[model samples]
Target: MTVAVGLFGYAVAMAFLAPRVLPRLTRHGVHPNLGVAAWLSVMTSVLGSWGTAVLIAVADAAHTWLHADRLVLSGLHEAEVIVTGHEGLAAQLALLLVTAVPAVLAVILFGRLARSQVRMRLRAREHADALRLTGTRMHRHSYADVVLLDSAERAAYCVAGSPNVVVVTSGAVAALRRRELAAVLAHEHAHLMRRHPLLLTVTRGLAATFARVSLFPVGAREVARLLEMSADDIAVRRHGREPLLSGLLALSGVAPAGALAASGADVLARAERLVSPRTRLRRIRAALLTGIGVAVLAPLLVVGAASGLLLCLI
Candidate 1:
């Protein structure tokens, strides 16, 4: 019970403070890939903390119900011992019932996340199947799963699935220069290669499932924006910024409902970023890496420490 309360408090504090601190820690997107990682790590940390807390609560409840000695921290053990001594089996039964609430809630929370991912993946697969039928397949040295849709409306998006499809409209191909089209294709391919869809799925699912949690929603938006920037960086690396910038200008339109568009999120900001001189914030990048490491390992470390202490007592 003590461990559970402490873990829950830590989770709450992280959820409240991480969003405020992470933007500064990411150094305003000096490295977009690292920024995406940092945001995802923080989200994972918060959720892990809550999950660990619930698990600890259930473990402690079961331990007390079965064992003669309490398996919690000394403070919690002392208080619970007093109650159980006075109230006997009633107190233990009540603790078990109380612990069951969080366990049930956690199951529901994760179930919703799983359901959201399944629905999204199914939608993306359907969209990809339709595009494959309607759109012409392109043979390119760099990318093979390219589909050219015969649409005048400029649109470019990647459908993430088994093969990972990149769909570009006829208007985008006609509007963009050769180099610009290649850059856009690189951008979409980067999305597939880096598995951005899975990232977005998890983040957005968390945001939707835990709408009341401030960090989940903020992290979702930041992750989406940063992933676009990350793909842009990859495009620039393969084909210079100017071409990608032109490509973005050509396809400055929203994508399909369940796809990640090259010009999808924060287009103006991405264009501005492309035009601006690049800065290699080495120090900030190092700091961000450190922060990501801490965010990922902190909850696990705490759980390890508590387990070690319990082992010592045993």
Candidate 2:
């Protein structure tokens, strides 16, 4: 019964929490949350099963220690009690069925959903080469080869795989001055360099599989945001802050949809933040907080597992 309760609890936790936690972690730049959540869920299920098995073993051992005479006497008395009382084999079976069925269903549904997303991503990659549009000056970067293409509408896209390519439209190109253009390129390059898209895709797939998956989409988004800042830093260092800010302002006026534009929706805000005197301090504080949070959570999780194991023994 305790094993069933644990399984049910774990399934409920995963089904309810994975989807929400993953996105939040991704957004906050917390990378470890997803792994921790997955590990915890799996550990909970395994420990729960093991605990039940141990309980049954212990009960059997105790019965053996007590001998056959007690068993026979108790069995007759228990039968009589069951005839007069509410609890019986039927009630126990019903309880197990009620708990086990939902747990099994939750696992099955979430697993299938995650698998389907994986298959879709894999299939999307097959057509990546065919989706190529024409462009000149494929800027070779550590993360990806970015090409500037002529298109009526502005667009920026990342093609996944080895030697990943980031394609930008001519409209996007003509929209920014030289420095802004450089900043744009740097941003896209950072995305490739960090392998953000692939990580996000995998994380999403995992999150879909388990409802409690954490630090995937949100982490990906935060990484995307930080990489942009990092690239902006590079651009500022190479080209100067004025040019980068100007480029941001100029691009902000003509940002594109469905593309990582040189100007994103929050470019002005980012530009403002960059020039802010306290930005560096904030960055340092954020980093320190993240580190401290991870340090604290790691041990708590370990202790939780040990406690769960101890419960199983009892």
Candidate 3:
């Protein structure tokens, strides 16, 4: 019970504080990849702590019940007798109800996450298939194949899957200067090489499944924005900021569902950043890493401390 309470309290505290603290810590000044890591760590830590608490509660209850007959003649004999009048079975049933609530909820949450992943992957595959059939192959790059659509809309996006593809429309091909087109292709290539689509998919699933968490929804949006910025950084390194900025301004279309477009996310903010990039201080980056480490380790420390206490008590 002590262990369970400690775990539950830690989970609640982190869930409450993480949303408030993350925005300030992972602002645009920090590296976007680091920000993504921080957000994912928080989400995993909260859910893992909660799940661990539930499991510990159920296990402790079962252990106590199984040893009830022995415990009646052991160190806790007097306390057990005085506390319950030997009504161990009744107490066990009540404990079962308490543990069952979270177990059931955990199952439902996992089911929702699974469904979301399946639906997203299926949609991505279907979109890939459609693009393969309708769009003509333009380049056979090693990282991702390029597909040319006949449309006049300036659409440029990448569909991630087996044999990943970068799709560009005729309008974009005509509208983009050679340098701008290269920058745009580099952006989509960065997405494929880094598996940004998969990252977005997982975040999207977590947000949809646990929207009430507040942190999950906000993390989803922030992760998407940061990922786009991260890709922009990669594109800039290979093709310079001007070409990518020009490409950003020239290309305009909504990305297909489950596909990442060069023009998707906050284009205006990306443009501004390209115009004037800010460098974070070394100390600030160090502090952010320290914070990430603490957040990731704190839950495990709680569980360990609780277990040690339980052992000493026994």
**CA lDDT for candidate 2:** 0.51
Q: Number of clashing pairs, model 3?
A: 0
Give the alpha carbon lDDT tens digit for every residue of 173-278 in model 3.
9999999999999999998899899999999999999999898898888888888888899999999989999999998878877788889888887888789847
> Is candidate 2 or 3 superior in lDDT?
3
lDDT of 2 by residue, 1-314 (tens): 33334434543454345446433333332222333333334334433443443444445434533453453443444433333334777854554455455556655755785676677566545534434444664566676667766775554555564556677778767776776677666666655665545544554454445434343334334434544555566566677887767766655234322223445535655687568754344554454455445434533454466557756665
* After superposition, candidate 3 runs with Cα above 4 Å error: 70-93, 311-314
Give lDDT tens digits, candidate 1, residues 88-148: 7776566656889899999999998999989988888787788788988885424337999
Please count the clashing residue pairs in each candidate, in the order shown: 0, 12, 0
TM-score of each: 0.88, 0.58, 0.90
Stretch of 10 with least lDDT, candidate 1: 68-77
Off by over 4 Å in 1: 68-94, 140-144, 304-314
The whole-model lDDT of each prediction reads: 0.81, 0.51, 0.83
> Which candidate ranks first by TM-score, i.e. highest?
3
In model 3, residue pairs whose N, Cα or C atoms come closer than 3 Å (at least 3 residues apart or on different chains), thus clashing, are none
What's the CA RMSD of model 3 in angstroms? 2.6
RMSD of each: 3.0, 7.9, 2.6
Overall local distance difference test of candidate 3: 0.83
